[model samples]
Target: INKDTFHLSQRDTENHQTNLQKFCRICGGSFKSDPYKRSYPVHGPVDDDTQALLRKKEKRATSWPDLLAKVFKVDVRGDIDTIHPTNFCHNCWNMIQRKFSNSPSEVYFPREGTMEWHPHSSSCDVCGTSFRGIKRKKRSLNPQLSKKPRMVAGSARKARPVRNVKQVSNKAVMKRIANCNKIHLSTKILAVDYPVDFVKSVSCQVCEHILADPVETTCKHLFCRACVLKCIKAMGSYCPACRYPCFPTDLVSPVKSFLNILNNLILRCPVKDCQEEVVLGKYAHHFSSHKEAEEKEGYAYINKGGRPRQHLLSLTRRAQKHRLRELKLQVKAFAEKEEEGDVKSVCLTLFLLALRARNEHRQADELEAIMQGKGSGLHPAVCLAIRVNTFLSCSQY
Candidate 1:
């Protein structure tokens, strides 16, 4: 293992399902013969590095206030009526109804010790609503056995109790099972229990205006989709309440229903001094049109391998011209020195200037090259050398 440490080795020894070690009969020392069983010393102590990294991680963890701002921008305590564990009041029930509109929903009834699944019965509750509920089976092991069922003799089949023999179809049971499986698969595929178009009745806690369908954040916080978008545009791209990291694409949902809701409730334009409303369907297009979009896109294009935006190409061209102008000025000074007959000084000055200029020009050239969508292998020296060779060759000619 020590010899193999510096060099790469692929060792595979698998077949054995169990291992038995030999014990010395005299000393009782257990032995493992395999070299892989031995432990080696690590190069250095990692406590300091680990501590520093841990500190950095803790720093990265968002504060509660920041998180709350992103998600619960409005007062959650105010909006969600507090309910006792025994039962949900009308307000909490209304909130749940507003959140999840379809398929009967209910709350936990602590008194009954069960999750109420049935919709509140309207006749029973006098609110014209039935408390939706589903009973869960309580199971336990009992030491005592109940009385055994008596078996009847096969010959006495005619003596069996004669009554109405209602024939039941097996297909009906199979259909029920199939329906259950379909529901299970659908929930699995979507990863969330989505209520259909229920967000419409939900209102912003701050504005008190009925929300135009809500968007679900990964943290499970709900918001008027447009309101959150506006918040992001106003703030530096982060989750409104928690300052959780986010991206425009993070809002996408695979399910058509959720996507449709998102499409219907997009935020207004996030630009400062601009009060234009951004329709849900047109958000992507609008964000793409921002003044900084091309610049940001250019950075992504060069460093992140995305397509360069049009404005980025223009900016790069302008920067290249500026670099070319600076290079010409230095070259002019070199010519003036050369004409004064100070050949060694002129050459040395030119060489140093070329080296320094190359570094500055490289940055500009990289911008240009990325704008042109070229690979990064080309060097500033190659371009500089070409210019020098051209000058030398022309002078000789």
Candidate 2:
């Protein structure tokens, strides 16, 4: 029994020595023992380069496990807890120290029921100036400085009492009278829920008369239809009010509601002795009737005249006929001149004569038809004259 126990003890000792020989003491790496090699102690203070190499190896070994764990989305703390406690490698420790070298080492943790300490600066950070108390100056004790002077109730200067004396001018009085007359005249017509001077306000800006068939331009200016057309013909394509570019085609008809309102307005007859107040829509008819009545009265007056008056009337008619014949002859001459290629002078002459005899619609119609038949050969001036004549005839109607 003693021999067998000794053999078992030797076997146990050899196994322990072999296991110890397989591992390095410094880096904890495994190695095989070789008969040709000599072994030395590796755990000791190394040279700077050797120490750096070991630190780098340790860092790489430690960091890879952490990085791999993070990449695989594994809980680092749980993994470490399952294996071993977390300890910084040499390089990591040095790196952390370098990163936070300027940071405070100790952080304050207030105890329960204890007030936290706060730090404050004694000087201004910007100018580095320390604060100091300043002494204020004392006021004088003289009576003038201490008390305000008082004046007697009656001694204060009184403001001059202003009296506005208005002087009445004769012209102003006359204007007021004219306004009153206009109001009186307007009152005779339909009663409108507008100011007494509203008629004047709604009058055409171009003609300074009550608007007839009012049209509004794109520029927002309002004008009578005929008045605006006349202006467009005279002036170029532009607004009269602000000179904004606007063409005749740009003039829009007033809204139907607006036209209805205007048509409802009552106006007095324009005839000298006629006192008829007619709605604007029927004014044309009323005026035509008045003209017909005036012509009949004129004819009756001539028929009721004595022999001498009849003779005088006959002579006047004969002279008017002679004048008409002369105008016809002049027109024919101008037309001949135009056909002979004297366009400018002939066109001017024709336009002037047509304008002078614009009231003769029959003659105007004949002239317009003749010029239009000439087509492209007609002078522009002559065409303008025909257009003006047409406008005048339409206006008369």
Candidate 3:
């Protein structure tokens, strides 16, 4: 055969071979096909049996439709009363068969036992402090291999092997610790007392407020979960502190040690007049009372300040009332001016005010209908008049 014909035949053979390679119909993992090995067809009946067993053992009715949808990545058309035949790899077939055939072995105690000395030291390697109970074993680094040069294909010079640096320098370690000081600082637990500088580093850089439910980015910079989420939503996926590219998914839960510290920290009441020092765990409950008190005081203050600057208040009220009246007149005149094609200013201002009100109340449906010129149960003229009246009344002291 000619070279071109032989190459074409070889390409076709590869394509055929790839097409013949079967995937595990159950798990969806690629099955390794061997010429010498015999393939077995493990149908979905075994899967149903295993699932039944699992449900029985767990004593809970588990829905497989959601899981099947994710696995198949298709909208299932009908109810799955029965599963179709599937081709399973040898290992998967064996595993399913063994699971069905065998029962789990129970734990049993030995009649005699012997004890040996633990290989771990009684003190921490880094801090050189004695451990309370059983000390944790120190992790030993692998022995460094000698670098050897290797000859590369089509290259005259030999390529030198890259030396892997495993040992961290003391300065680099200290710098990393300093960078993570924010997490340690916020921790109130005395179990691991950090430096004063570390303790003071718990505040968010954006709001300069004590971090709550802190999430750390890939760059090691920490921020409050809400603050960071808001920043990311408003801006783009980038760390506010270091400007390092970070996604919401990259924000990880703080370590258990940090969580313990955060929960135990003493926080002051956020209200201006309240001087209550609250535990971090109890802050949520305490803050609610503080907020209610502040709101009550605010209403009381508004009522008490009625006659303090009566003249100035009266002037401001009169100005607001005049503006409201002018707006109302303009809206009224729009019906006639609309026919003359001069309704943009009056209509737009009224629409904008309605939109502002809708946004403030988060009534998206009402806003959409209003924007479409569909009155929300009330006549547009009546709504505008009511809004203007409310605005004028609110402006009055």
Q: Put down candidate 3 lDDT per residue, 1-397, tens digits, no spaces.
A: 6999889866654443333334333433344343445344432223466567656656332333333332233232342212221243454444333323323322121112111111122231211221122256775545573454454664633332222222234224323323444332334332345576666566565544567778877656777777777777765565666444457887887678877776777765545767676777777788678678868987773544545634434577667676468666766677566646456645655666676765543343345346658656665666566556556877621
Q: Rank candidates, lDDT, best first.
A: 3, 2, 1
What are the per-model numbers of colliding residue pairs?
27, 0, 2
Cα-based lDDT at residue 364, candidate 1: 43
Best lDDT among the predictions, by candidate number: 3
lDDT of each: 0.38, 0.48, 0.50
TM-scores of the candidates in the order shown: 0.19, 0.28, 0.26
Candidate scoring better on TM-score of 1 and 3: 3
Worst 10 residues of 1 by lDDT: 12-21
Score candidate 3 by TM-score against the native: 0.26
Candidate 3 yields a Cα-based lDDT of 0.50
Distance from true position, residue 172, model 1, in Å?
50
* Candidate 3 positional error at 345, Å: 50
Candidate topping TM-score: 2
Candidate 2 per-residue C-alpha lDDT over 245-275 given as tens digits, one digit per residue, 9 for 90 to 100 = 4567767777787777777787767568876
